[model samples]
Target: MDTMRDRFAPVVSRILDEDPRVAVVLAEIGLVPFLEAQRRHPDRVINVGIREQLLVGAGAGLALAGMRPVLHTFASFLVERPFEQVKLDFGHQGLGGVLVSAGASYDVSGGGFTHMAPGDVALLDTLDGWSVQVPGHPDEAEVLLRQAIGAGDERVYVRLSVQANREALPVDGQHLLTVREGRRGVVVAVGPLLDQVLAATEGLDVSVLYATTVRPFDAAGLRRAVGASAADVVLVEPYLAGTSTGAANDALADVPHRVLGLGVGRRELRRYGSVDEHVAAHGLDAASLRERISGFLDVGVPGVPA
Candidate 1:
């Protein structure tokens, strides 16, 4: 199965073909797949070399010129390195564009800390009116990408990752989909981590909520889920830990609730390990998540002691 980044090139290519208003700006991160798209539309598919800031600036400039720009790069460079440009060129200017990113969290763990961007979503949260999409599957990524492109000059961030679920769930770019119904508690799984969350919470009496579009977080959906289940919520995101805890808290501000944020930890792992190894190290794998989730919800696992 192709990863989310694997599906991005073709999706953007089709969008570029169908919509003349769409433009793609890159910083030479994943340029091989887009070589054909760039060949087809030289004016629209732009490669600004390794200059991350310039890539964002060019995208903003295109947006200013009445084109919907789709900027792509490694998440670290796309959001972190060029954040100032993103803040000024787009946010401060009151312009809009789609920032599509690869190398989610620690997908490129061997590439070292410089390539990983677990804090991308958290950093974007500092800005206002930015719609963030973390698609669990390639199909969902395509859906969210198209939705972002079609969203009429709204600032959208399409976060693509190497990690993917076994299957794709229906995502409408807004609202959360309840995967499993239970009364113990609610586990909100964001993007690619849905499968792990599902595996971890197996047999546990807790509602599972799948979230592909995180920003403009489904407050209503969360509230509805909490209304049916216990107010204890566990947010399992693929990015930085606690990234959406605030959003969840705000969603349930009126009610008394408990939220446990789970994701990549703040401390950097010095060793370069495989993705699976990193997942285990960060305590994000199914086994670890099971222990943590069950502990937080005060539930007993079948073979584990209470």
Candidate 2:
């Protein structure tokens, strides 16, 4: 039976096949798939040794030279180690390419702290031309990948779970996916986590916005989504709380809103597990989301009918 990871591998592989100018700079853990693609299409893959900093720097250099580079690595190593390189070389120059950070947010089991930290989008939130995208599922991931590739100027960060996630109906990076109609409150889910928002709204009426792109956020779409609904707005993300989601939410603060951000608290290197396990441990499950949004609505608009 095909699993979630199975669904994702092919899409990236497809990109590899179609773009002769593209080379995948992948980590040891990320090697197998790209290697397989190369086996099928010899002379396509570029294996940059496991050095995270070198991987990111080389990717930026490749983009500068007009070749598309897909830099793949574990999330922690990708964002944390060579952040300066990404910020200075990629973001500063407004280079285009996909930074595929696998094991995004503890998705890989036993991958260790070196592998897991729910990526904090804040790291790139301030870089001038960098945009962050966390896809909700297979369809979203594919669409976002194409959009990022086409988005030539900005440094696009495509973050996804190492495994396949429940696929939501396809949504454009430009269109916000609505989870509910009559809004009692708006919960803007970050990525594949849209499933949790859907579950949270089972018996209640609330608005849900699925953000495919955190930076270069679909502002017009968001303004319209929130404007149509009379409710408080909250942003949810896998990053450190009060960082990317909060910053993103604050950018829209003029909309008469109250915002709440979600993420794994900051720490050295502690827990190790799959993304699902980490989410459950951090109270990020469907029930938790439902309860939290409900509470936010209650506090924001007293006596609002469910």
Using lDDT as the measure, the top candidate is 1
Task: Work out the TM-score per prediction.
Answer: 0.97, 0.86
Cα-based RMSD of the predictions, in order? Answer: 1.3, 3.3
Best by TM-score: 1
lDDT of 1 by residue, 1-306 (tens): 988888899998999999999999988887889889889899999999999999999999999999999999999999999999999999999999999999999988988999999999999999999999999999999899999999998999999988999999989999999999988899999999999999999889899999998998999999999994339999999989999999999999988899999999999899979999999999999999999999999876578653
How much is 138 displaced in model 1, in angstroms? 0.9
After superposition, candidate 2 runs with Cα above 4 Å error: 1-9, 39-43, 162-165, 228-231, 244-251, 267-274, 299-306
Count residue pairs with overlapping backbones in model 2: 5
Candidate 1 overall lDDT versus native? 0.93
lDDT of 2 by residue, 151-235 (tens): 6555778887744447656766665677676556667777766777667666666667777777777766666777733337667
Q: 96 in model 2: Cα distance from truth in Å?
A: 2.1
Q: Given candidate 2, what's the lDDT at residue 278?
A: 72
